[model samples]
Target chain A: MNIFVFVKRVPDTESKIRIDHKANKIIKDGLNFVLSPYDEYAVEEALRLREAHGGKVTVFSVGADEVNIILKKCLAMGADEAVLLKDDTPETYDGLRTAKIIAKVLKDKFMDYDLLLFGRLSIGADNGQVQTMVAQLLDLPQINVVTKLEIEGNQGTAYREIEGASEKVAFSLPAVLSAQKGLNEPRYETLKGIMMAKRKEIPVLPLEDLGMSAEELAPLMEVVNLESPPPRKAGTVFEGEAEAAAKKLAQFLHEEAKVI
Target chain B: MVLVFIEVREGKVKKSSLEALSEGKRRADDLGAELHAVLIGHELDELAPECFSFGATKVHVLESTLLSQYSPSGFSRALKELVEELKPMVIFFAASSMGKDLAPRLAAWLNVGLATDCTETGIKDGRLTVVRPIFAGNVFATMVFKASPQIATLRPNVFPLVDPVDAKGEAAKKNVEITEDQVKDAVQEIMREEGSELDVTEAEILISGGRGLKGPENFNLLRELASILPRSAVGASRSAVDSGWIDHQNQVGQTGKTVSPNLYMAFGISGAIQHVAGMSSSKVIVAVNKDPDAPILKLADFGVVGDLFKVIPPLKEELKKIFAD
Candidate 1:
């Protein structure tokens, strides 16, 4: 089984995001970047599949040169190789253009893969569109938010969490599956793994190499404006004995909220 | 025409889809276009009238055994075909699990732009603009789609449902074509959570706990409180679910479940933006945490600084008394 996983570098969840009003962009200074949490699960699932099925796992990402740090982390987690599709444009591409680029690369450059893995969604954009878009672009069956998966021969069965229920789906091979939480616990990189990762070389592919032009990758949607959500009005905060606080809370709920 | 996808399960239209229909109706009226609804499921002919009452000028019905359960390929293909024939200026879908999975595929197949989890939408300069929360709920970005037939998935509960009115004499119903072979992915079964009631997305009141509860056993206190509140459901932060304190189905956060309950009460949850994104739209928010500066308190309408163990027991007792009265 040849498994390919797509990873993205996003701001750490705990990082404080500041919008640069003048520039109309997020200020990246003084911010920490990490492999998207959901992508870590995707990389881990790929490694586990490779270990069980006796094949190589290659990690791929679409970003600038700074994404090498995240690719190295994937290598440390037992991926056999890494590929970075360097975006020439300064602006972020929408899901359609991004998926098109990835699909082109997979179809024209790395054609050996039998399965593709992706995080359910990236926290930055939070659009959760690329994986499904990639599946559609490639005409491959796809499942999103998969929590449990099993594979045998050329068929796969996946369990995905829906609103109040779970669904069991069966699909053919060469499919795209997005990893959700509870799929499996990702293993941390060891000292030896980290040392080995430093020695691994990641090839950065340019848009020209993938037969794509800058204009072809332009975003379909334009950002009009961005603003911080208005702060909630200050409310009464009780600081007293547990009983008094509870009594106060009950009174507020009944009188103000009126849910009771 | 502006088209809205009316999601149905077990032969009933979903509340979120109704909200989407209401949004679609508003946009259609604004654009002076007809509002159309698409219903896909087995035995959904009976539910088509609900769409008309919700302001659909026309209803498109596609019934097939293959569509009884949602398959991304199946639904997207059918919808794509219908969309091509209809040539709608805008399409609306509820940002439920099925919509989130299907909308992107349809957008990609049509080579159009899609905005997901939109809290607000409107027409500007004869184009569709959507406002969606990013970085969880800390920042809001307004986006405009340059492509024709713009697609958007509206967050549930954000839009008001249209007041029920008499059906405008049965909407013009038309049947779309879809064959079983078009559905590539097969669903073996849909396993529902045993003895679970009120999914967080639809719950009117939610009582959520975080890691401060100390252990999974402590969730019983939340359950006891929930039992007394009508239509209330239990929710957990990602931290609690990650720590195995509760099932992921009950998780309320960016990656878990986005909800807008009538009232949301957080216990020991430090309001992470991820958690806040899911429930910040609650009509009323109450928080209890030992730390005064927990992020959730900033968003709550009422806050208490105390240990949850001490506060919850008494709070539940007080709530029982108030409700009893």
Candidate 2:
């Protein structure tokens, strides 16, 4: 069995995103990028599956050269290899196109592989749409936000958290699975693992080399504006006894805000 | 034109689809394009009337036994076939578990672009600009797809559901066939979870506890309140869940379930952005924390500054009185 996990290098979540005061775009300087935490789960799940099934796990990413740092983290966590789809990102791009480039590059390989996986959603883009789109492109069966998994022979059972309930789904080999956080406690890079990761492979597959055309999949949307949410006013305060506070709060909702 | 995937589970429509339809209607109107809906199910004609009420002019239904249970290949094939034929301007899917599985596969097959979990969307100059939180809701990213059909998945509960003034409409019958090969890999069994004492995601009202309740026994007040409110459920912070005071299923935060209920009551909880991201969309948010500086109070519509041990029981009693009367 083999597992391929997709990863993305995204801006750290806490960076104060600044819309260039004049350029009408986001300023990319001074920003730190990391392996999307959700994808971390994907990598961990793959490692866990490989541990049980006896196979190699390959991790892949789509972004600039810096993305290798994030990919290396996967290797450090015990993945067998890493592939960086190196392309200088434009000021803006779509997840769907990202999925296409990934699918085009990995489809043939995936056909040979037993399983393909990704994080439930990326923390950077926060649009969990890419992995699913890739699964669609590959025309493979996919299970999303799988909470748990078990292997019996060639078949695997995926447990997904559905609305108000949990569902167990079984799929044969060669399926796509998107993992949510807490699926497993992603192991940290131990001293031994870090030393061994240096010997692992990190290959750069150019988008053009992969034979995917950005122009073939024409984009449908463009960003006219970029800005952070308006800062909220500091909240008001109230001090009093419990019963009186409750009465006042109720009065406020009913008479003032009318939200109750 | 916009193509919205209408999710039909167990014969009826899920609440998230209504939000998708509403979002689709707005996007279609903005783009000056037709708003079409695709419903794939085992047998879903009974849901046609409901789909139209959400502003779908045309309903494409693919009836098949394979769809009775979810199969990714079948869903992707059905959607890929539709996308090829309809050539929608933008595609909308709710970022529920099912949509998460369906959207990417279709986008991949079509060789298009997609934005997932878009918190906000607007069309300007024939382009769809989407905004979403990044870095675990630590920052916001405004982005655009440089791909066709502008496929994007909207997070459920993030977008407000619209009640169209004249919502009544008729759906034209759509005859589409779904083959067994299309829906490969079946969900053989569903290890159904036991009935939840509090699942805030689907609840109309949520009572979430934080670390301030002091002890697990203190949750009695919150539980007592939930029993009387038929639509209410209880939730807790990650701290509470990890503390063994509550189940992880009841956790509501960045790492937990996001909810937008009619009412959200926070007891002994400080609002973290991760915490706020999950439930800030609620119609009304009330917090009862001892500290005035609690983050939860910043966004709350109503605030009660007091001790939870004393505040919760009387508040529950008052709620009982108001509702029982």
Task: Go through the candidates in order and give the C-alpha RMSD of each one to the true structure.
Answer: 1.8, 3.3
Docking verdict class for candidate 1? medium
Misplaced by over 4 Å in model 2 are A11-18, A21-33, A90-93, A108-111, A198-201, A214-221, B26-35, B119-148, B158-175, B197-199, B214-220, B242-249
Model 1: per-residue Cα lDDT over B198-250, one tens digit each: 78887788999999888999999899999989988899999999899999889
User: DockQ score for model 2, please?
Assistant: 0.49
Residue-wise lDDT of candidate 2 within B1-325, one digit each (tens)? 8988988766678777889889999998988888888888666877876777778887887766667777667777777877888888889998777787777677777766667667788997898878865544444567777667787778776677877554545554444476666665666666545657335776777888989988788777788878877778888887888788976668886667767677788999988666776676677788888888787888877777788777776776666665665
Per-residue lDDT, model 2, residue A99, is 72
DockQ for the candidate 1 complex? Answer: 0.72
Give each prediction's DockQ, rounded to 2 decimals: 0.72, 0.49
Per-prediction TM-score to the true structure, in the order listed: 0.96, 0.88
* Local distance difference test values of all predictions, in order: 0.87, 0.74
Candidate 2: tens digits of C-alpha lDDT, residues A1-260: 77888987776544545667466566779877777767888899899888887889999887788888888888889999898888776635456667777777776544568888988777645666676666666666778888888878778888887766667887776777888755787889888888888776788887767665557544544554555655545444567888877667666655575644
